[model samples]
Target: MELERAVGTYLRHVALERGLSEHTVAAYRRDLDVYVEWLRARGIVDAEAVTPELVADFGAERASAEPPPAASSLARMQSSVRGLHRFLVREGRAETDPSGRLRPPKTPRRLPKALTIAQVDDLLDAAGPAPGSEDASAAQPASVRDRALLELLYATGARVSEIVQLDVDDVAQGDLLRVRGKGDKERVVPVGSYARAALDAYLTRVRPALAAKGRATPRLFLGVRGAPLSRQSTWLIIQAAAEGAGLTAHVSPHTLRHSFATHLLQGGADVRVVQELLGHASVATTQIYTHVSVDALRDVYATSHPRAR
Candidate 1:
């Protein structure tokens, strides 16, 4: 079968039948498009013409390009190519899966960047009303909501998607938050007192005001128009708070999450407990924070230890 036609079929299958998200489908399309172009350049336009060596060469070429793709991008590209070949074999369009032996580029495991406790405090303070504001009523509802959102993110270590997907009823007794994580997995995480207080203020004072601007929705966080807050908006909230705190560095929602895990580990929390709290599928995934804690310990030891340097 023609490579382009097979690629189109596979993309459609993944989108309509396999039920992949639009973002995922787009990524597959992009990666496959590049793969197909490379194959065409090599005079191997038929799906059956694709070979293991050809795919490996393509990866090597991409890796050797000026300002070569990062390990993560290379891995993603390789995955996309492998998936296409697998689909071709499964559908009998190709005699065999040429990408079966393909290996993703090894990516260095970078430690998660976490804010110091003082820096986090500064960020949270910036998210709230300025120090010594005489009347809380003077604060915009959106400002109040942003503070609550930031607090909830740091407190629960919930992904931005999970936090924004929260419904009004998700907060249970004992300051517990019912979070729906990746793959629709639900886990209950406790909200710290600070987060709970912020949530109460937002729910009682600000959320209703935002909700009144449009029809009611079950979504916990809303924009000024009462529409559910988007992932992009949540990112912008973090960025704004970081800027307000005079933090020139990039700040993402994941930064709060990294800080949450690292701080917990520094406080001597177990990795297993953190895995459960962060909704990580494996303890191995949560173990990265241990490295962060160790790095911090080393830094302290280097600074404070009496050993000869």
Candidate 2:
């Protein structure tokens, strides 16, 4: 059978039987399409014609190309190729998987950039009405909502998707927030006093006004038209707040998340505790923040220790 046709069959199986999300399936399809094209160029359209060397050559070709693909992209492409060959073998279309031994390129560990506590404070202040301003009375419902959204993001370190998915009932006693993270996994994270106050203000003063604009929904954050806030809109909100705070650095929801974890680590929180709070599937993922804290300690030691220089 043609390798290209077999790729289509595998994609369908993943989408329908494995229940992978459309977004993930589409990504696999794109990567596999490139692989198929590469195979066709070598006059190897038949599945049985594929060899381990051919797969290795494909990786080398991508790596040596002008403006080579980033390590992450190359890794994803290799994963797609490996999955395709494995599927073909399982289906008896191929006697062996040529791409089985292929390994993904190693991506450098890029530590997440976290904002300082002061910067986070400034950002939150910018998201709401300025203190002692006469126009405080004129502050819009959207401003209140923005403040709550930012506060909740920092307080829980929840992804923007989780924050937007929140329902009114998700907030429980003791200022706990029940967050639904990736794969619909639920975890309860504590809300700080500042965040709780911000949420209270938005819920009591702003959400109702916005909800009146359209059909009522259980979503925590709503747009001007009362629809659930989109991920793009959430990013824009963070960007606008950062600009208002006079922060030239690029700030996104993930930045707030990084800050939350880093600040916790700097404050002596356990890595395992942070892992649970962030809903990371692995403690190894949470340990990255420890490196951020170590960097901070080194900076402090260099500046404050009298004999360091």
Q: Best candidate per lDDT, number?
A: 2
**lDDT score, candidate 1, position 172:** 51
Q: Model 2, 147-170: lDDT tens per residue?
A: 889999999999887888888889
lDDT (10s digit) by residue, model 1, range 45-124: 89888888998898889889889888998899999898888988888778899888888988999989999999999998
TM-score of 1: 0.85
In order, the Cα lDDT scores of the candidates are 0.87, 0.89
Give the Å shift of residue 43 in candidate 2.
5.5
Tell me the lDDT of model 2 at 76: 91
Taking all chains together, each candidate's TM-score versus the true structure is 0.85, 0.84
Error of 2 at 124 (Å): 0.9
Model 1: lDDT to the true structure:
0.87
Error of 2 at 246 (Å): 1.2
